[model samples]
Target: MSIKIYGDPGSGSLRRITSAAAVMGVEIERVNIDLFKGESHTPEYLELNPHGLSPVMVDGDFVLYESSAINLYLAEKAGSDLAGTTTRERYEILQWMFWSGEQWRVFATLTFDEVLAKRFMGKPADESIVNLAAAKLRAGASVLDAHLAKHDYIVGDRLTLVDFDIAGPFSQNERTKIPLNEFPNLVAWQQRLLETVPAWADTKREVDVRIDTALEAAGIKL
Candidate 1:
């Protein structure tokens, strides 16, 4: 049975899962979910993921949501070293995944929604919300930058889901007004990771175009 993934192509949350699937040799069927139209609230989608979140995976009779969990499951299903070669390495990857989800992901989402997303939607960003989101983003970046300074990948010397977990959220840093130059290590890590994955380029290009249109429409030069 082919695995089914419900997601929005314009959003990077699900891109990480699909991109990982490609790198791990996991074949999947992608179902586009139009979040702007409230398609996620429809009964069909709610059955798969009641929270109405993107990147729901259905393999055979098993259904799962939450991008990180789906990524973990896909990694194990592929039986690859993405989870980590050793038990300790696997645990460390899990720790970073959780931190990326709880801290990095949250701030990334908030900043985009409050800042870049509003511009994309042809509205002005809420300065107060942007301030808070930017502060949290900087804090998260500091820790990540320090860690990346010592390591190429998040959990180990090689690529892992930990890298994907952290990379996915900040993939659009330049377009979203994220100041990557301030965190040199983090910027370097993100650059190398994206360049290493061939499948990521096209989707990233598409996202870049979207961000460009948004910024232009909002009269904000980047």
Candidate 2:
């Protein structure tokens, strides 16, 4: 069966699937939906993802949206251990992935708006909002760092889809200046995952290429 993913390279959410594909050596069609140009709201894309979000996946007739959900599905479809090998392992993986979305995503978005949006997109950032977000983000980062200090991976000693869940946003720390210096374990965990996983490196390079292509096509420089 063929798989198709619709997203943009610069998207943190979309990066989850693209990087996973690179790790698994999975062949999936990539459909660029440039939110920069309001491509996600167009009729065709809205039909595919009613929420008009990035990283929508279509496997045969099955349509999936939300990057976290798609990560679980992709692992299952590929028979990859990234899904985890047993009931408890799978449950913990899902739990961490869900927390990444429900809990951590808010902080990621906040930092993106306050740091990256202002710096890259020239959008105005509200200082009050940035301060609020930073406080919350720091609390969560500490807990994550503590967890990482105890375990090499989210579920077990192996890299799973949960790593992608946690790693994607951390990768943006340099760009967003999200204050990860305090979370050394979290920082080191991300570094180890990227360095050890060949597929992850492939995904990073692929994303760079895609971003360059899109930027050039849009006459935007970064």
Candidate 3:
């Protein structure tokens, strides 16, 4: 049976899982859970994920929540080196994944929320909020840039689950205004992935379209 993924195409975390599936050539059926319509909070949907988050995965009777874990599981099942072939590699991969979510992504989302998300809702961005978020994002980017200067990918020299986990948010860099101009290595790394990974490029293309459609529906011209 094909794995089923429950999430909106506009969701960054959902995109991460789908991009990994694309890279590994895994077939998946995407089920839309409209956050705006409160579909995720419905009783039936909540049963799959108590937190009511997007991008839950169901492969037969097994259900998985959290994007990073789901991607790891998919990689392992697909026998892709994206999961890491050795224990040390696996731990290091997990380290970057955790850091991606806990340290880096939080600020990225904050900036996106204060800027793009608010703009979509016909709201003005608060300068204080946007500035704070951008500052944090820059600090995180600096660390990532320094690391990336020495390594091609987040965990190691090759593309892995950690790359997908960390780079997913950067797909919104144009819309969210992520400050990466000064980080040449990080910018170059992102460009390399987009150019080399057909799956990621395709997934990001679909995401861009969805974002545009959403913006049009909201009568917001970009």
Please report, in order, the local distance difference test score of every candidate based on alpha carbons: 0.80, 0.77, 0.85
Question: For model 3, what is the C-alpha lDDT against the true structure?
Answer: 0.85
Cα lDDT tens digits for candidate 3, 74-167? 8888898889988999999988888888888877878777777788667887889778878887888899999998999887699988888888
As a TM-score, model 2 comes out at 0.87
Could you report the Cα RMSD, in angstroms, for every candidate shown? 2.4, 2.7, 1.7
- Ranking according to lDDT, highest score first: 3, 1, 2
lDDT minimum window of 10 residues, candidate 2:
115-124
The model with the greatest lDDT is: 3
What lDDT is reached at residue 194 by model 2?
76
Candidate 3 ranges beyond 4 A from true positions = none
Q: How would you encode candidate 1's per-residue C-alpha lDDT over 1-222 as one tens digit per residue? A: 899999877678887887788889999998987665678899988999889788799998999998889988988888988888898998998898888888778877877777665655668878887787788878989998998999998887898877877887666766667555689999888778768877666667766665566467567764
Alpha-carbon deviation at 81 in model 1, angstroms: 0.7
Pairs of colliding residues, candidate 2: none
